[model samples]
Target: MRALIVRHEHVTEPGLVGDRLAEHGYRLTTVTVVPEPRHHAPDVPFDFPDAADWDLIVSLGAPWSVYDHAAVGSWIDGELALLRKAHHLGVPVLGVCFGAQALTTALGGSVEAAPRPEIGWTEIETDLPALVPPGPWFQWHYDRCVLPPGAVELARNAVCTQAFRVGRSLGVQFHPEITTAMVRGWLGLGGAEQCVRHGVDPHALLAHSRAMEADARANTRLLVDGFLEQVANTTA
Candidate 1:
């Protein structure tokens, strides 16, 4: 089986999700939507590969908002179109954070700026705990998904909707793919300033992420297993 990994920014990587996919006998192909030079502000025209060609698609997080059409509208428009096409073709998608917001918009939902940004680790309430585990999940988003019609919300928190399912696709607002290294990379790339703005210490966040590494990996594995057995197989 083949999995198409859509990375929105250079700093973001597949992390444990890719590891789990490989363990499940999936060959991964990554497509970086916004590469190095264009990382900060993506303005170039880009297109996604045919959704029918891949067995699965995993859309990674981004620093940009889905509603920022003025700055990133050019490529985000294409991404929304691609996500819609993938859904229509019954291609399974696992959208994380910004990717989830994009999926929501593509599926006839809406994205809006949250009253407050959710950063660091948080425990969420879930209707389907077996499929979507509660808490200690890493979150770093300033927006929320209103949920597409027919989408079943699996989990939520005081701040935002954490996870949802629509047909074969699953969207999660938290970063289940987070690692200490990834957090460090994000911090280096202006994330530190964002943390300061939110009154969070970047160093402390990194340390906490390091402490949660082992448990995070285990949780991610369970999530991937649940997704394959529950979501993907049922849709198939």
Candidate 2:
């Protein structure tokens, strides 16, 4: 099988998620939308590949909001089109954080600023724990996804809807692909300051990530298995 990973920026990589997919016998192809140099001016022109080419599509998180067209420009529209096409083609999609917001928008929902940003590791309220575990998943977003029509909400919290499913697509508002190295990269790129503003100690957050490395990996493996067996393979 083949999996197409959409990395919104240069820093965030397909960590544990990609590992799980690989273990399940998938060849991974990654595409980066915003290069490191274009970090500030993210409204760059880009092309998204055809969704029909890949067996599965995974869209990673971004620091930007899906509704902020002024920041993302036409690329947001293009990604939405790609996701919509993927859905129509019966292609399975795993959308994380900003990607979840994008999926929600593409499926007739909307994205908006959350009451407060969810930073650091947090647990959610899940209706489908076997698939969407009520985990202490990593979260770093200022926006939330409103459920699209015909979407089954899988999980939520006091802040926002954590996970939802529509057709063969699953959208999770948390980071299951997190790694210590990824956390360090985010911190190097002003993420530390963002955490500080939100009353989260960046240093402690890093420590927590390092300490829970094994547990996080195990949880991610379960999540990937559930996505494939219960959601993606159901249609296949």
Candidate 3:
């Protein structure tokens, strides 16, 4: 099978999700939205590839809001178009964080700023315990997604909708694909300010992340495996 990963920035790799896809014998191809020179910048080229070319699609997180086209450049439009096209084609999508917001937007839902940013380990209510871990997934987003049309919400917190599914597509508000090095890079790149702004202790975030490393990676693998299995069943 083939998987196309739409990577928004250099930091947001597919991580354990990619590893599990590889385990499932998926040929992974990444389409980096932002050019190397503008890796940190929100500006990304708007062009999109044919969704029909891939067996599965995984859209990674971004720092920008789905509605912030002015800041994100033309990529927002392209992403929305891609999501809609994928939906029509019944292509499975696994969207994370900003990517989740993108899925909601493409499916006639809305994205908005949460009352406050969620930054660190949090316990969310989930209906699918088999598919989602209960707590301590790395999180760093100020925005939240509305459940899209035909979507089944799987998890949530008092602040936002945490995870949802529509047909073969799944969207999660947390970063299941995060690694310790990825978290450190985010922290070193001034992400600490956001944590501080959100009343999250940087030390606590790091500590909790370290404590949850084994569980987090295992959960990532499970979710990826679940997603790929669903993809297989759909095409069977």
Best candidate according to lDDT: 2
lDDT of 3 at 3: 88
Where does candidate 3 stray beyond 4 Å? Answer: 230-236
List the pairs of residues colliding in candidate 1.
none
lDDT measured at residue 166 in model 2 versus the true structure, 0 to 100: 94
Q: Please, what are the lDDT tens digits per residue for candidate 1 over residues 132-159? A: 8886899999999999999999999888
**Ten-residue stretch with the least lDDT total in model 2:** 227-236
Count of clashing residue pairs in every prediction: 0, 0, 0
Model 1, residue 138: displacement in angstroms?
Answer: 0.5
lDDT of 3 by residue, 31-77 (tens): 88886578567675557888888888899998788888778988788
Candidate 2 residue-wise lDDT at 31: 96
The alpha-carbon lDDT assigned to residue 90 of candidate 1 equals: 91
lDDT of 2 by residue, 69-116 (tens): 899889999899999999999999999999889899998999988999
How do the predictions measure up, each by TM-score?
0.97, 0.98, 0.93
Give the winner by lDDT: 2 or 3: 2
Instruction: Evaluate all candidate structures by whole-model CA lDDT and list the values in order.
Output: 0.90, 0.92, 0.83
Q: Assess the local accuracy of residue 66 in candidate 1 as a C-alpha lDDT between 0 and 100.
A: 92
